[model samples]
Target: MRALTHLRSLLGSILEKKGAAWPDKATIEPPKDKQFGDMACNVAMLTAGKLGMKPRDLAEVLKSELLAADPALSKVEVAGPGFLNVTFAPAFWQKTVEEVLEVKHCFGKFNLGRGRKVQVEFVSANPTGPLHIGHGRGAAVGDCVARILRAMDYEVSTEYYINDAGRQMRLLGESIWVRCLELLKKPVTYPEDWYKGEYIIDLARELLTLKGSALCDLPPAEGQDICYEYGMKSILDGIKKDLADFRVEHQVWFSEKSLVAAGAVERTLEDLKSRGLAYEDDGAAWMDTTRYGDDKNRVLRKSTGELTYFASDIAYHADKYARGFNTVVDIWGADHHGYVPRMKAAVQALGRDADDLKVILVQLVNLLRGGEQIAMSTRAGQFETLADVCAEVGVDAARFMFLSRKSDSHLDFDLDLVKQQSMDNPVYYVQYAHARICSLFAKAAERGVAMPECSPALLARLDTPEDLDLMRLMEQYPDTLANAAQTLSPHVVSFYLRELAGLLHRYYSANPVLAASDEDLMRARMLMLAAVAEVVRSGLELLGVSAPEKM
Candidate 1:
């Protein structure tokens, strides 16, 4: 990040001297091959035509000026048509390691967000059922995104939107009541659309255990109400426990019922009506979401005097804005991708920016056992829950696998592969790199060798290609983090760790650390290894995975 800033500053100064406008910052990048240089710039290529100079000639002038501006720049060469290849002195590279030590755990953090309030609402699955594998993917992706945003300096709020006021909860109540009647050997007719999962039966048994046979004698309507309250609390509590076990946490558990009780839905409807964004249609209220790019107008309230889910959602989003968040992000399943436009329209209707509400769609997960897809256990008669997957593969492996792919792509989760301890498993590979470094420190302590103090002279002793290569990779971390945060993608971090681990493994294989013939060389290598281990620990923490000292 500092390299790019210095390059841009140089270009800005040169442009000012020539009374020309500064160019875009995006044009600067490192060369494809490390052999080319430490950094490269195309500013001369961008501004040469306006300056009435050939690109190559202009690059030569900028190269000389860059070399003269800072002693840290060892060499600046003109490459290709107009690229300025810049290499930092060995002393500069040593100072880079010192900077890493200075920040330590705070390494890779950025100020891109600058403390803007952002709310990320994800895995808000209905509280009527157990969280399945799809919800697991959403939970991992969403939580990692929130952590990365916080690292980027955003004041982030993570939330779970409980759908307690919906029809699903009512059906859940009815399902439990029917199960209760059947358990008592009473005649009962179950609805075709009601839940048939074994969990519903489990809830019914718990309800019976708590209330006894007295609940069986109440009027059907009163009995169902009792079932609804108990079932909702029990199922929601179970959901929270599952999420906690999986390391997915939420700062707030917002309830849909609370919105209705606070009259927020009604107030939002009135606000829309006053803004001329709502209308009466055949004894119902309609929102003109089409005006804001929805495919069609939507019903806000039905003719039966019931608010639609869309209306409740608008109220929920309005409440988010009332809490002073500059941005509201919703991570949803791929099936809800079509719901984005209407929600954005609702945001605008509530006097917020349409772009304030950003939605990310997570695709499906294909769970595999021994390379064959497994829908569910026929004996169990139910699909796998998030807790089940976590229990099978452990929390660290589950999270790394979930975030190993882009959110919108279908992910084939191979149980056999993730459980392996070899380098083929990315989570294992990265964790092994950290453990390798820890072992190195242990051996050093046994040999009475302490970590060398970082200084320009001491670190300059590392002049080999592998040493410089590792330095370049470590320095690229901040840029990689910024890219991931800007794109709202945490998968970049997964890819980064794997590559860094691979490089560390290769470098270790070629260089004998503890057995180096020169004591100074061993100490310098150990200090470098410490930097690598710190970075791996930091990156894994952002993804909410554990970095163990031993495999």
Candidate 2:
């Protein structure tokens, strides 16, 4: 990273001398092929036209200036039309080990956000039932996004929006009430449309235990209300426990009912009307979402005067912006893909840029065992709870696999694959690399050999191609984290870790660290592995997975 920073500065100074503005688009990165060089820059192609020079000519000048300005740059060549391929001296890369050791766990952190406030609201499933595997993916993606943002120095607050005040809550209550009647051996008609999960029966038993037969003696409406409150609280408590067990936590649990109780929905409608965005039509209050690109106007209040869920969502997001979040991220199910445009329209109507509202739609997880898809039905009460999956596989495996791809891509969560302790399992492979390094340290200590302090002379001994390749990959951690933050994809980190692990595994097989002919070589390799272990731990922490000391 220091190499990159220094190169950028040098190029900036050179462009300043040439009286051409430094292009923000200019980038220095690792070339795709290692044979090309350690790093490549596109400054010439980015600035050649502005300076009235050919790209190749500009590239040559850059190459000459780079070699003249930095003694660490061993080779600089103009490759192709306008690219500068750079190779650093062996000593320059050797110092990277020292840098990683010096920074330790904070090696990949960057101040990209600079304390900007960000709100990530995710896994806000209705309290009608336990979270299924689909909700698990959202939890992992949103939580890891928050973690990655924080690693980039963003002031992030996570939230779970509880859809408590809705028809679903009423149905949940009636479902429990019917179940309570059945438990008491009373005759009752169970509606086909009601929630039929076994958890509803469990809730009924809990309510009966708490209030006794007297609860059923109350009027149906009154008894349903009681069941509603009890069911909501019990289910919400279970959701909280399940999320916590999965290593996902939210700073806030915002209730939709609270928004309505505080008159925020009415206030939001008033603001929209004041902006000429809302009007009364057909005995209902409608928001002119069409003006903001929605295909049709959205109703805020129905003819019967019931506020729609969209109205409450607008109010919630209004509250979010009023709370001073520079950016608001919503993690929703992929089924809500059609809803994104309308949500963006609402945010724009609320006076925020559409870009400020980031929505990530997570696809459903296809839970599998032995390559066979498992059937899941939330309404039928025959689905795998997130807690069940975590208990069976593990929090680490579940979290990692949930983040193994883009949020919008379907994920096949094969139960048996994750439970395997082989290289085919990504989480296991990455974690094993860390454990292997730890074992090396333990072995060295048992053999009475201490890791040497990093120095140019000591690290120079690690000049093998494999040694340098490992160090080069280790040095890219900050870049990988930055890319992840920019793309809002924690899977980048997952992919990077897998590559690092694979390289480390291959390097370990080819090069013996503890059995080296010279004691100092052993010490240098130990220090390098220590830095590698630190990077692995940091990456896994960002993914909310543990770096175990042993497999």
Q: lDDT for each of the candidates?
A: 0.88, 0.93
Per-model TM-score on C-alpha atoms: 0.95, 0.97
- For residues 1-551, what per-residue lDDT tens digits would candidate 2 score against the true structure? 77788788888998899999888888898888999999899889989999999999999998888889989889998888889998988778778789889989889898999999999999999999999999999999999999999999999999999999988899999999999999999989886689998899999999999999999999999999999999999999999999999999899999999999999999999999998999999899999998889999898999999999899999999999999999999999999998898999999999999999999899989999999999998988889999999999999999999999889999999999999999999989999999999998888889888777778788889888899899888888998999999889899999999999999999899889999888888888888899899999999999999999987
lDDT measured at residue 15 in model 2 versus the true structure, 0 to 100: 88
Distance (Å) between predicted and true CA of 294, model 2?
Answer: 2.4
Clashing pairs in 2: none
> Can you tell me which runs of candidate 1 are displaced by over 4 Å?
79-81, 376-381
Segments in model 2 whose C-alpha atoms lie over 4 Å from true places: none
Compared with the true structure, what per-residue lDDT tens digits does model 1 show for residues 326-386? Answer: 9999999999888999999899888888889888899999999988997853124368888
Model 1 residue 523 CA deviation (Å) reads: 1.1
Where does the lowest 10-residue lDDT sum fall in candidate 2? 449-458
